[model samples]
Target: MKIIGIVDTTFARFDMGSAAVDEIKQYVSARIIRITVPGIKDLPVASKKLIEEQGCEIVMALGMPGAAEKDKMCAHEASTGIIQAQLMTNTHIIEVFVHEDEGKDEKELAFLMENRAREHARNVVDLLFKPEKLVKQAGTGQRQGFEDVGSLRG
Candidate 1:
């Protein structure tokens, strides 16, 4: 049986975490253990504990960084920490962050966050069960909202 750990932050919009978890459940049959922290900066240690103590195979981290310089800096630091945790545990952590500036309005931001969370949840499933799906995307530069012009030369 596979176990997936989900780490989310209260600073993010509420729906993002739920969306990711829902999407993950739709594709894989795994026991999901969720941990909600107060902010993005708290994810790394929680993620490490999930992997080392909770026996999770993979982790999905969800957070939203506000449109402020400080927020961006904090997000960067958190991301680096998560990478270190992944290396230490030899496990995969899917970090999904939606910056508030990515959208023009609150509605758009919420929509984007939800979509991004779901998309990354699918990524988590692919990484665990169907890695080939992701390998095929290498160097494609294909993002969620953009068209894929893989190796196309004008």
Candidate 2:
């Protein structure tokens, strides 16, 4: 089974004959073909054609150009700081005007806020595992979904 997945051309140059490419050649079999696209915009179209021509049954893709990369930028500090910021802002605005942990309930609320942010980060990672299904269109000859994070955020 030959499988094709896309990668960012800016981040890595893909070679079908290279050892790394050979390793993921296929999700199931020994034969695999990895094609590097100039950008994320071209992955789906390329995969669709490859699926038809190469008889690719499953297309498992990976591109960490962004999503997870966000976490790796000062992982330790951001994890604590971002959540703390969210807690302080949301607590006063939404929950109640409690900035510091004076009571047991306030401390628990702060803890919950921190956990929620951490969970949000985990969700970000979970979604990053996919092409980010944002908008979907269905027609007689074409079906597509756009997952570009930049476009999604905008």
Candidate 3:
């Protein structure tokens, strides 16, 4: 059986990692490994360790960036680190970041967190089991949280 890894931050108000695991369970039979860290920057190392030490095939790194300039900067740095981890391991680390500013209220933010994490969880299933499903939708403007912007040609 395959193993999926989820690395999330405790700083996030919502439990996006649980949302992801719940979603993944609906579509796959793979074992899931989850690691919770204190902040976004800690995601990459945990993700790397999941792949290297825990033998995960793919990882989902989830975080929520606060609505502040410094938070945005930290998110960017975390993104860079996630990319580096992916390249170093030659594996996919799906970074799911829902900025606090994305929603106008707490309810909406929670919705975005669940929606984005679940959507990415589906993407992980597609990647591991049926990559052609994703290829079939390429350039179709598929957004995870908010409504898709739609294809430019359409």
Candidate 4:
């Protein structure tokens, strides 16, 4: 059986990790491990630990950056760290970040959080079990939280 890690941040108001778990369970049978950290910056190490120590094949790093300049900067740094961890581990860490400012209201924000998490969770399943499914959709402008813009090639 495969192991999928969900490393989320407590700073996020929505339970994106749960959304992801629910989505993944719909497709395949894999051991899902969940880890909670304090903030976005902590996602890299936590996800890395999940991969290296906990034997996770793929990880979802979920975070919600506040609607502020500093928060955006921190998210950027955390993203960089996530990328580095992925390179070091030679594994995929799907960064699921929903900026607080992306939505105009709480309802919209929650919707985006859930949608993005669920969509990425499906992507994880594809990466683990069915890469060709994703390849078939390449350049299709498949947005997670919002409406897909569709492929440019008509």
Candidate 5:
């Protein structure tokens, strides 16, 4: 059986990680292993260990960077490390980040984070089991925080 690793940080809103896992479980039958760290910076190493030691085929990393300049910088560093780990492990690490500044208020931020996490979890399932859905959507301008453009209908 295939396994998926879910790595999340405590600094983020608590619901995001659980939302992702819930969505994944609804879609696929793969075994999921979850690890929570203190901050986004720890996602990479934990993900690598999951892949190398725990035999995960892919990892889903969820984080919410605060709306400060330093926080963004730290998120960037964590993303870079995640990329390196992906390269080292030769596996996909889906990084789902919801910046606190993206929303107008606390409630909006929470909603956005939850939706994004669930969406990315669906992405993980598609990556593993149904690649054609992702492939068919490519270049359709369907991205995070935006409505699907769908080939620029005239």
Candidate 6:
């Protein structure tokens, strides 16, 4: 199945574009996309193509908690919950990545957040996207050209 995905870079804390895709590609083969809010709001042309032309089946909205305080349990708990999509109300996954202030560099923190969001997205896809679709695959599929999560290869 040809699928279009959307990852919102609304917050600057994490790499929403790449990080969101990292979680999804592990579960299915699809044409993933990442769109920034500013670009979408400012440039109608890009939004038209991304929203109208591409025909994204599922838009996985991604976000990082702003301000260290907001990154507490509240944001983390929010990510592991159900949320409606922005563009297509009934056809989006509002996935979020939240990091804790445990004394780590931005890189390390981002890594942890990305992995958490990736797994969280998987749960969303399995539970909501295609309930009957079997995703529990044997073997890593690494030798078969299927890279691990966070890979850009097709």
TM-score-best of 4 and 5: 4
Residue 150's C-alpha lDDT in candidate 2?
A: 38
lDDT head-to-head 4 vs 5, winner = 4
Where does model 4 exceed 4 Å of error?
A: none
The per-prediction CA RMSD against the true structure, in angstroms, equals 1.7, 18.8, 0.6, 0.5, 1.4, 9.4
In candidate 1, what are the lDDT values of residues 4-54, reduced to their tens digit? Answer: 999999898656778878998899899999999999999999999999999
Candidate 5 regions exceeding 4 Å error are none
Q: Clash pairs of candidate 1? A: none
* Index of the highest-TM-score prediction: 4
Q: Give per-residue lDDT, candidate 4, residue 130.
A: 99
Which pairs clash (backbone N, Cα, C closer than 3 Å) in model 5? Answer: none
- What TM-score does structure 5 among the candidates reach? 0.94
- Using lDDT, rank the candidates from best to worst: 4, 3, 5, 1, 6, 2
Order the numbered candidates by TM-score, best leading: 4, 3, 5, 1, 6, 2
TM-score comparison, 1 vs 3, better candidate: 3
| Evaluation by TM-score, superior candidate among 1 and 2 | 1
- For model 4, residues 33-150, the per-residue Cα lDDT tens digits are 9989999999999999999999999999999999999999999999999999999999999999999999999999999999999999999999999999999999999998899999
Backbone collision tally, model 5: 0
Worst 10 residues of 1 by lDDT: 145-154
How does model 4 score by TM-score? 0.99
CA lDDT, candidate 2, residue 13: 23
Native-structure RMSD, model 3? 0.6
* Per-residue lDDT of candidate 2, residues 4-103 (tens digit): 3322233322221132233333222334445655533344444454445665433322222222544344233333432443343331100111122222
Model 4 weakest 10-residue run by lDDT: 145-154
Total clashing pairs for each candidate: 0, 1, 0, 0, 0, 0
C-alpha displacement of 80 in model 5, angstroms? Answer: 0.5
